[model samples]
Target: MKKENIKKVVLAYSGGLDTSIIIPWLKENYNNCEVVAVSGDVGQGTELDGLEEKAKATGASKLYVLDLKKDFVENYIFPTLKFGAKYEDYLLGTSFARPCIAKALADIAIKEGADAICHGCTGKGNDQVRFELTLKALCPDMAIIAPWREWDIKSRDEEIDYAEAHHIPLKINRETNYSKDKNLWHLSHEGLDLESPANEPQYNHPGFLELGVSPEQAPDTPTYVTIHFEKGVPTAVDGKEMGAVELVEYLNKLGGENGIGLLDIVENRLVGMKSRGVYETPGGAILYKAINVLETITLDKESAHLKEQLAQKYADIVYNGQWFTPLREALDAFANSLAKTVTGDVKLKLYKGNMINAGVTSPFTLYDEQTASFGEDEDYNQADAAGFINLFGLSIKERAKLSKSWPKIED
Candidate 1:
């Protein structure tokens, strides 16, 4: 646990502003410990470009760029989708991603036999809890170092200054500074003008909107997309079968073009602070919408309703960094059982940020057209309604008779 004892440290590196400076800070504070940077490639695309060189240039002894795209989608994203977990209005993008990445970091640490695992999560953010809890769960004996809590760097400006002093190349400056976290599921923007709830997001600002145009700026024509699901996992887009990562990527283009998934919310962090964030989750929004429509047909009334109630609690568990707990696994088992019938196809119309369900179909649908029709059918007898109503209203009828027999009160 002591600084002198840490010979090598595995850091969760993103090649971002905070992490770029962290390499040097770790060396200075931890007696020049060998720093090994591990970057999780969760479909951030060009964000990971040149990351290895960048890490080495920043004084890291080595770098590992693990391709976690498929693992991230299949293991983390799909399970959460089955549970329909959303933390407030967040879609649990950044919330669930932390654990997935940390799990990878823990594995790499074990393989490298590193003395400590380091992260750039700040003291006041939910990511600190998420990353540390996962590390604690996966590798209980590993030493963990969080620089944001120990380092004296007070602000982003100080971090930038530290980067310059250490000759570490950075992609951010004070003026264009917006703290961003991007994964396959979503891209989250925070800080600067977003700190104030009243300031409208500057979507038009150069480099501000990476995914797509705003809803108002989208084309006038509507775009239609058909999604196929098998056992609650998205399998294809627009009649073309795709792998999990490819399907999400394909939908991201479509949804972004139509301005589909943009949200601004003020949410309660696990650290007990209210934080405002803007999220762009183009592909994920469409998938969630389509799957929910299919669930309506596939799931029975009680299972569907109970899943809705359980989703809130599941969201809390994920958001509060309890992903490895037994309760989460139990909930996943329930969700998976319900999802067995969730195979179907959903068609949707995307126009100006609106997702309108056009149609839904499933082989396991519970809807029976003949039984629900208004016309007389052999499945039901009209005379049965009278007896059924009488039995159903028996308590009400007894209460009424008792009320009449009671003496009237004086005015």
Candidate 2:
């Protein structure tokens, strides 16, 4: 709740080039504020292995590496998945993770008695908005320090050079050039060749497709997977119940083998510019298909139609980092209420990069075989249709007759 005198600052550290430079940058700018590096473990794997010691070596007063994989899957990913959210056909893999990570940073800031929270997100990226909005939502009093907007560095290369000049350790590897953000649900790749929409993504190596294989390299045989839902949340896969984290992991493996859930889109950033991004969201895509199938079987016609409309808006709200706003909360409530009847089991066949619906069943299904049957039946609804049609078309017929009586216009 203080002005500019920030005694301490907690940064959302990722042990990347940008964050490695940010520790020194924050210290240089903030009048000797203690830098507390906090790394969130959302399934970044070995990238986080040496992060704690690396943070200390990078001049962090303290390093806090919180393992949030469970929370990320259970609280953040699942809730968003309930609505089958996708931002322009790209599973909101990176969008939903930012708020939870930002929340973690803000929580640490509160606990550390830090006046400010720092993030390495650039001014031009969606993450800056995502991180700041979350900080505002959770800890409105906390000050924010965004180095990309303030620092003299012009590009990622310049930041890397700064890190090199400052003797910061480098953990460069084959997956180096392209900027990537990975988590349990999905992995997103941007920058470099991905920046150009015309450039066909070169999926040549192991880490090229972060989650799994490209469609071209996938196995020839199809893989079938069944997903069960209770009140719109994925409960099990192939009749086997598993925890949230494990469920996503399992789905990812199956979907990846089938070469499913790969997307390339040139999206309009929250900032002014447009950027092309390639996303691998195997698990998310499968879950979305399964849930949509379930909804079709269980939800009534009007609710299903309304949900389709709301789902897009919900994706936009989350994609635009408006998760904490009142409108988002109201929309979430509306989504949750609609999801109540969306309980069922969806059988899907995954073959050579395609997920085809096998079947779906639910107790609340509105599909009635007897009433819908064309053959002879005791329901006897065919004769009643003549009278119903007469009344239903009366207004239109009357209006047409009146139009004929009016003076004809010259064509």
Candidate 3:
């Protein structure tokens, strides 16, 4: 975009140090462009506090905070859960949130007649692709600016210095500034000492991990809870039906207490790089496991196998910033179809990081106790197996008759 002609820009701002520093950077570089800050509330909870005042103090001309938590969990997160998509064991907390947040940025940019849409996603991360792809899909003509790619502040230390120089107030100092993302689905931690593969996570380090404790610190006794689902979406825990947001929040509390979900991995990013990170997805972990267990009895072998293969494709799409693509929409339709039989209750016993099945029941189960039992039943006869097995192995039998292995057996 031509800096001289641009009058205004819209920024995807979070009330964090990273984005806070960008507000001033845009004005200084873009010929004093007026920045309209937009933040989407996807259950970051207290993280959104004082965002308005912070945005204004940090040089944003105006701020628009949209309440997107309900839509976030219900639409984006639930579909991933239904498809059982996991990218290298990550629950995709930050991946899905980018589209929701970037959509808001695009809409606000268009509505405000802003010249460009800007974001603080780093040059090395997957989020830049996620944000830019959504912006291109929604508002292709709008000029897009990513501060990390353009700015000369080469490191977090330099960025902190810039923030302090501009008199920007921040919640983090240099030592504790882990690149983090938090939302309704989960929380993620990256950077700092976590950059090295050899370094074990300092789990007990003061404030290192949040949302849950380390598994070793979990209770000795297992915590049992029954998860109820209706058409693949988790509806309740222990017979208490709840709204989508409320249900996830409740499970977060229970799951966190038992150290339910904590993931660490080095994952391939869409930008052609691998980055190591830790994710805390307590409630999401419980739900993903619960739905898989519930589907075990309900789904037929062929359908279950087909869906299992498709789930990986769906996970790749979400991770690769293709959330707004037509292919993803088509996959979602199939996921919904497979999830029709996924209504049930899954009783799970959580001990440390382990999720053991206590019980599972569903109305549409394909398994029949009478037909499968060893005892005599009208649905099946023992003698029928001989003829069926003979027919099933006819090709093998014919081949064996023509083979030399028969001579060895006869001898």
Q: In TM-score terms, which candidate is top?
A: 1
- Per-prediction TM-score to the true structure, in the order listed: 0.96, 0.94, 0.95
Q: Candidate 2 on 260-329: residue-level lDDT in tens? A: 8988888888787888988888888899888888887787888888878888888998898887789878
Pairs in clash, predicted candidate 2 = none
Collision pairs in model 1: none
Better-scoring candidate (TM-score), 1 or 3: 1
Off by over 4 Å in 2: 1-4, 173-176, 405-411
Please rank every candidate by TM-score, starting with the best. 1, 3, 2
Model 3: clashing residue pairs? none
Q: What is the lDDT of residue 181 in candidate 1?
A: 93
lDDT of 3 at 268: 87
- By lDDT rank, best first, the candidates go 1, 3, 2
Q: Write the per-residue lDDT of candidate 1 for residues 1-411, one digit (tens) a residue.
A: 889999999999999998999998999999999999999999888888898899998889999999999999999899998878888877998888889999999999999999999999999999999999999999999999999999888899999999888898888789878899999989999999999999999876667878877998788999999999999999988889999999988888899988889999999998899999999999999988999999988999999999999999999999988999999999999999999989989999999999999999999999888788999787988889999999999999999989987898789
Worst 10 residues of 3 by lDDT: 402-411
- State the lDDT of candidate 3 residue by residue for 1-411, as single tens digits: 688888899999897877999988888988988999999999988888999999999899999999998889988999999999998888889989999888888889989999999888889888899998998899999998888888888898998899889899888989888988888889888899899978998876658777888888889999999999999999988999899999999889888888889888988888888889988899999999999899989888898899889888998888888899999999999988888888989999998988899999998888899999988788997889999999999999889788856555653
Candidate 1, residue 56: lDDT: 90
Instruction: Please state the error at residue 153 of candidate 2 in Å.
Output: 1.0
